[model samples]
Target: MPELERDNEVELAYGVRLRSSGVSATVGDVRQAPTATRPVRGVVADELLGDSGDAVARLLPVVEAAGMRTVLAVPLDDVQVPPTPFGGVRALTGEENYVELSVPGPDPDEGQVVLEVDEVGLVRWHIDVEAAATAVAIADNGTALAARGVAPVRAGIEQTFRIPIVQLDQGGVGGQQRGFLGFGVRKVLHLIRFPIEAAAAAVGKAVVGWWEDRRRPHALSLVTPESLGDVPPPDGVSAARLAELADKPFLVLVHGTFSTIRSGFAGLNRSGGGQPDLAELVARYEGRVLGFDHQTLHVDPTTNADWFLRRLPTDRPVTLDLLTHSRGGLVGRRIADPALAAAAGVPTPDVRRLIHVGTPNGGTVLASPKRWTTLIDVFTNLFSMLPEEVATPTAEAVIELVKQVATGVFNGLAGLTAMDPGNPAVTAANAQVFGGGASGAAGAVRAITSDFTPAAEDLRLRALNAIVDPFFGTGNDLVVPTQGVFEAGDYRVTDPFVVQSPSAVVHTAFFSDVRVRAKLGEWLPGAV
Candidate 1:
């Protein structure tokens, strides 16, 4: 162990070297601890053991079983890396100084180093570990920087890796204003390595099990008086209830990926100052509103639609209007697909009107296989700032997905791939649903889209947008592309309600807006 001084590289214990220039901070000796101890700090600890801890706890065992023997803890002072030569900062910051580590062995397992910078940026690791499939730099807040297609650079016999340890301005977002003070606590960097294949298998198993336990793929519950707004239904829709609801044109609510009906439409629960709300919408359908809750991470939308169709009563004909958000819109479209309905051996419900809020009909690049890590990064940062809009469990699901992706286990995530522009499923769906134009058999297709640019007063959101806007070159709602919601292949959406820039309305907050509520009321007219 040695003390690190400015402009001089010091060799610490375990064949690791530390160096710093332009930045001033006290670097502590690197110590090793067992991975079971969970030696983590700042936002990483908060994400792992937060309110959604139980949901994400399954990931730890996967990491431990991947031959991770011990964790390395590196301590440093509060440091901030200024904005890059470019306008905005990326997920990884401060590439100038490097923390080099040498593993003296013939062969070593795959390893990872988790670094945090004042709860903002993450340091990148350039690994030359032999036979390692990939090297990823993960931010404390669950942002992963991985070389997707590129193979890891293999050096000589002695495996040596250099990690860029940097800092972020504590005065910026998630700073003192947000009550994140890192004064006395030691900022420890946890380092662990494991076999890639074994880790991938373990991650896949754990995540699949977790998804199976949490998601109800074919569950459909009605919105009754007892389960009005953001309240979970006591039970699934019974055969009698379905027959009764099928007598009239009912409304169906479809939620997006990593979300439940209660969480996705929670925004509709807010009072709209004499405007229409969720209660009014439910009453319009005479309490016949059905909510489709399905698995979103593992299965494709067609599968979800098939499961949903199977739950419908075959004895009666049903007519329904659809209200969908995000990926749920894809499922709704599939349900509205007459060919698909026929294939599923069920009569297609007469879809009178379909309202898609923040739906990615044209697909979002963020869901591309290469950009999956960036998608997680965007969601993690957005959820950190807007915690109230997203439920903790939903956020935890995102966290778990990111963790699996970071560990090179992103092969089986078909649901996310369905949102990719190049995905055949998306192309086929677009061709079938919107191919016949807006007046197609699916009925009147409407959308509520937003190009969210944070207002001047929303400093935190603005700061986040500054870092995130670069990922999506065009206008977006911080998740899906703005124009993609309404503009598909040959079909051009007509007269969609668009939320312009420089507003507080984000993708998740659309239903909370009075103007959106007004638009919904105007379109549906609620039992008038």
Candidate 2:
């Protein structure tokens, strides 16, 4: 890396380019072969190229290989590097790269993939929920940060970063391929940009996400505790709907904690316009839909299960088809639990199928004391990223929110205790749902405990998010490390999606995901 000049020309030891624009011969000729001791240098200026002295060394060899006598820096070549606050770039597959939230953390362990916050280190206290919050911040603010010069990497759970493999022109540094970055003879800068449309899309999505969460809860509490007994059918349903339910098997969609009906099915709004192909799961089971909502934060699984028992017919010959997401899976589990039902004074419903979109059947790392510190630190950083005027207030708000989470539910709410892995209800559910042997509950618990934790994650996590961190702990969905819905021995009656993957399915998304929807179609009796 060299010092950047105001005119934008980057001065190398050998010569200077008009800019690092990656154009050929735009600057004075300087014949420096990359193989030579001296290297080539150049730069260009535009929206995302260079500003305030962003430079890189060892670029000469690559440029020389591209065969250009004059300097023409491609804007994309230097993205994801220097002067860029947002992106964190690393080799995903060999020389290829992958861009992520780009935050700091301890390097991963031998076989794990941990995304530890540099400050938080690891969860060590009730306040560590902030670390979990920070992970959320990275996800929430990721796109915004990318807007300011982050490179466009390939997309997928386990995708490639497409690094440039230079092929020197036959004519060498002054040849036909000069200035080209190897795309069938073109000198184009294919990189990400912060376009007006993108910003608009972000705004639109935020609004959509808001309305989705806020709008669905008041359907006369069709799924809420307030509407448990003899509640009128939800807004759009007709009186005939009850009769329809009696004749046909019904689909019950259970939402996770802090989620709404739309979140289980609809897509977040686009930053520019319109929406993604959200609600695919919802669409398939259209005729048989029954969305369930509940007070998850303060309420226990037994309470939610009781509501489910009250809402559905006790003696329906047909079992209800169930689709549960995140903690909703716990509710579904309770519905399936005869003992729990008996204890709660509720009748159990027969289940047709259970598809989970990242349920913490084994609880979450965010709840681990050793890991919460990291969670809190990351969230605090997110608040710090705000403007000073808002930062203080934002921090205060976060503290208050955490306070509620801590106190409102578990009498100090376990300090956001419901999510705690150590929660009695959560552990009990895992024991029952996964079975109690090594091949069952014990194994899954061990994986979630040793493999999913920040310490184990360092050794087990992977870029594909495939090796557990979201792939194969026991297999994980990033959030849920088991990579599956349930264990083989859990039950022969029906299968359950215990651990989730792709990060999306770990919590809020289920119906909106096509693969998930397709799986539902295959697994459910009448789903299309």
Candidate 3:
């Protein structure tokens, strides 16, 4: 009979014996659960001697005396058990590892999940037992025995198993540390099922649901390019391209939208009186030049940005001078997260001297109307089976497109609002910033009113709010009207916004202003 000590609970070393396809092998004692203390040696001795007949033969007297047993006690060449008396454990030979860990269950539950780590030093084998529940037994060598009469391993419950390694204590045995990425958190799904298939489906659904919830961005934007060109590079202007950038005050150029590094640099080179090429820009400055790729609205910006950053080398230091056009600014701001900043060892941005060219710092009324309409349409289509007149109409396709649109618009709105000083979200974001000065907020605001408005009678000033409004009410772009940009805010009639940036002017009078390039050169001296 197995025995236990009065003062201490003996550790009964547990394992499995498996045989399949006419082959059999032994597995050694393996741990089924984490224990606070090492188990008593006496229990191991009784276990090895009791059930595993053949294993009892090789149990080292010293270890056997301590109550430890190997898994494959009997040789595969011999068949002794009638195979009928076996109730909880199944024996298989020649199929993979002969051993399988088995645990009987009235119905699958967290309690029934079979967990085991890789063995060390000897009996090295590759096994996986992550969050898994199984009707099986495991050996120190990773050998497992399936439960004789129980159903196969079910889903919803994870099974964690690993192979043994030569090193017992160097820490990375069986890649245990790497495999358990989601440590300390409960899996969102915990359902029970029969035959394993149904349970697996439940688990898959839960994972997909969790992923969907995290797929969208709260806000986003598509930035227009910023220009820093001076009138036709006069004779000396050519030198401007070669001008030393050290203490000369660098103008960090950040690209927006779907531009690549090559395209961004080339566009600047092709643009006006002309400035330095990327190489020249990098050469002239004492500081390093950097570029960033924000997540695509059409794609997940958060995830894309992560991939972008993952490819960057941020270990080195670079001087800070920033100029972001369009949506690139949102990404630039996010890198300002406290933890991220601290980990990267970067100082908070000095946005006081910061300047934006064609940045839509405030929510763009023009964009908002399109976005709002899109959202409305999405809701409409989701509820109806009618063919959408919109560009694409397949249910699945529309759903994906809508998700992308929503992510882009929401992130754009959030970024815009957060940049506003009096905005609540902005205040919350700054709570953790060192010195806590409000984030810089400035950008072009297109005028929705006509110059002749004053001459006309019966004009009542209104807050710029939505797209349909004629005068710069909430939603208007200069042409679209203020109503398009409507949201709760301090916008009012007396201090109405006016479009003044050179880019905005260029946008309004591209052909009329033949001197637009000249204006660009004057405003942005470092642009080509």
> What are the per-residue Cα lDDT tens digits for candidate 2 across 1-528?
333222244433332222322122122222222322212122221322122121111111221232222212222232322221432222211133212111111111100011111111111112212333432443344323223221112122221111221221222323343321221122222111111112323443221122222432323122322222222344534334544555655667676654444433332211112222223333444545666765454456566777556544444433566667766776776676666555655444456555555666556664443333333433333334333332332233233233222211112122234455545645554445433332221111111111222221221122112211321325444444453334322322233433233233333333435545545555555542
Superposed Cα deviation of residue 473, candidate 1 (Å): 0.6
Deviation of model 3 at 60, angstroms: 78
User: lDDT at 125 for candidate 2?
Assistant: 12
Total backbone collisions for each predicted model = 5, 67, 86
Candidate 1: residue pairs that collide: 79-167, 80-167, 80-168, 81-167, 111-193
Q: In candidate 2, what residue range of length 10 has the lowest lDDT sum?
A: 103-112
Stronger candidate by TM-score (2 vs 3): 2
lDDT of each: 0.59, 0.35, 0.27
Order of models, best lDDT first: 1, 2, 3
Point out where model 1 deviates above 4 Å. 1-206, 213-216, 224-235, 385-390, 433-440, 456-459
TM-score of each: 0.73, 0.42, 0.31
**On residues 342-408, what C-alpha lDDT tens digit does candidate 1 reach at each position?**
7877777778888889998888877875556556655554544433434554565664564454344
Candidate 3: residue 79 Cα off by (Å)? 90
Model 3 Cα lDDT, one tens digit per residue, 403-481: 2221121222232223333334433433433333223221111212112121111111111111123223432223223
Q: Give the TM-score of candidate 3.
A: 0.31
| Model 2: per-residue Cα lDDT at residue 437 | 33
